[model samples]
Target: MDDEARRDHRTVGDVDLTTWRTRAGRASASAWVRLGDRFGALPLLLVTLLIGIAIAAVCTWVASEVYDAVREADDVAVLDRPVLDFAMSLRTPGLDTVVTWWTNVAGTVGMPIVAVGFLVGFTIQRRAWTPLVLLVAASAGSLLMTVAGKDLIGRARPPLADAVPPYERSPSFPSGHTLNATVIVGTIVYLLLLRQSRRATRVWTVVLGSVFVVSVGLSRVFLGHHWLTDVLAAWALGLAWLALVITAHRLYLTALRRDGASDIHRPS
Candidate 1:
């Protein structure tokens, strides 16, 4: 063929160049889409898991350091004692009442009710079993971790004289109330934000959850029931666990979507 005719035909060596390029581009796009559909959540899950592990390690280190200090009667423990004494010194009837109220609300009794209510409500509203399972697992796991950590560390609580009413005898390296509250409130906020689309609503949900978690942690110290480090460790540990739960749930949803499950709701 002449040069002009060859150009018009858009062919190279008897192969249609335009057609080949178009097909190649389409194939590349299709492969990318398929890859994304299959494994797009993998990177996020991996990154989250890594971060969770790092945070958990830091918490463990902190708890261990505190445990060592207490065991050896080190300076850390000496300083910690003054903080507890100060916390006790600030106590008044009204302040005690308010702190106790928060402690009660976020403590064993009130937290269980809140968790169960959320579990039942989410299960009923979403008509899904996975959420219920996820929440129950999170709560149970938190309880297990709290108990295990306390038993393992075996750190003593503040002196009875330093504490307010409603004293606890459990070992208190990491505050159970703080850890449990973090997980419970964090999970609830995660689930709520997942279903909510509005930015304002999500922001409010996060804010409220943060306040609840922080208040619960501070109440433990304010009541002289735990040292400041105990609450800090709980925050880190609870956050790590919370991150794993959230990552797992998102992964499950991603798998469901890939498997052609039409009823699965994507997180917002």
Candidate 2:
């Protein structure tokens, strides 16, 4: 065996059925095709590992830049007040109640239920723990980011007076609601797509997930529970972490294909 082949053999096992499903799914994506074509079997995992690292670095850089601006209250941070004020102005007591209830349903409590339900349902359907593991990783990483951003920046939410009832006290530079929704919902859709081959289904899945994540972010702002910049940073940070997880899955598949896993092309 070549040095690279020997190295890959040591790094990961031959392809398993469930993970092979991910590889099968990616083969249909043009971007994934371009990415995979560049790698020979031996170096695929190594290259994927490098790609995941690059994604992490870019995400951290983007998040940090947003943080620095917010910390200094310049750049995009300058719009925080006006945007928030406009959101506040549009609210009436009825609207505040509606948005607040919806945010609650979509944010902290609701997201966990949806994630756990998805993990359980898919684990049953696929008879595989891969989806469960990914969900845990996505949820845990997002929660860690939320806590770290809150602690590191110690940025406060809008005054309780401006916010709807049942106010939050956490530091709010990056909205946990927005961050968690983006990571969890985004991960769910990606996994769902691995098993979905229909063009219309995939398109709708992407669209729905995007709307849900965006709604979560906007809800935080409308409720005056967070600033506009907080949600933007949350999305950028969430996307970075999601990239890391998905690429790690891709790396797993790359290892499998090296051992002769079949292409298993997407149906037309």
Candidate 3:
């Protein structure tokens, strides 16, 4: 009935907490050693940091350009109303109902549930933490950007008169639904690809994931819940964050080499 006894009770991958911790500790130590031995920690870190900064800057610039275009009603903003109008023209009561249902999968309440489902399923299946760690990093950054962009830009949604009901109150420069869908779904797809072997299956998985992400973005414009520019910015921002997450994870894998983290992360 002490700390040692408590570790005996807890478990992961059929190993008790104590054993799991020891294995994880060893894997981590070995990974760092491999990293330092191969490239030296400082140099690798500097290289990764520079790449990350470049990716972030590009994404930020793209989003900001879209935001300005929308604000000034020129450039890409020129297409905003016409696209919305085309979407509106196609809107039937039946179509509206279906699109609304589809869009909600990426909405505030629904997206969290979707993320939790993936996290829980991955943990239970693999008994590993790598996917959750990477996915959470990707999502947390995207969520922060969504909130920050909304607040800073304070962009308005398309006129309520044009939108479907159950209206959202948040500022709408970057569509939260589109951004979350891009990052969360994208990361899931990427993690799955890491362990996937069948070429046919991998192709299908990527195709379906890409289609779903695009559909979610389109649904926002169709529902008049977000402008075309909002979805565009979200895509740019989400891709930016997702790229950073994947690059960082790849760097970790490079450091870990094939011995410890590679197999640990790719747990079958």
**How many residue pairs collide in each prediction?**
0, 0, 0
Better candidate by lDDT, 1 or 3? 3
CA error at residue 37 for candidate 1, angstroms: 13
C-alpha positional error of residue 11 in candidate 1 after TM-score superposition, expressed in Å = 46
Candidate 3 matches the true fold with a TM-score of: 0.75
Residue 113 accuracy (lDDT) in model 2: 89
TM-score of each: 0.72, 0.74, 0.75
Candidate 3 per-residue C-alpha lDDT over 167-215 given as tens digits, one digit per residue, 9 for 90 to 100: 8878987898999999999988877776566777778888999999999
Kindly list the per-residue Cα lDDT of model 1 for residues 49-106, writing each as its tens digit.
Answer: 4555455555566667666766576645666777787888899999999999989988
The lDDT-based order of candidates, best leading, equals 3, 2, 1
Question: Ranking under TM-score, best-scoring first?
Answer: 3, 2, 1
Compared with the true structure, the alpha-carbon lDDT of candidate 3 equals 0.72
- Supply candidate 2's per-residue lDDT for 171: 89
Candidate 2 Cα errors over 4 Å, as ranges: 1-66, 258-268
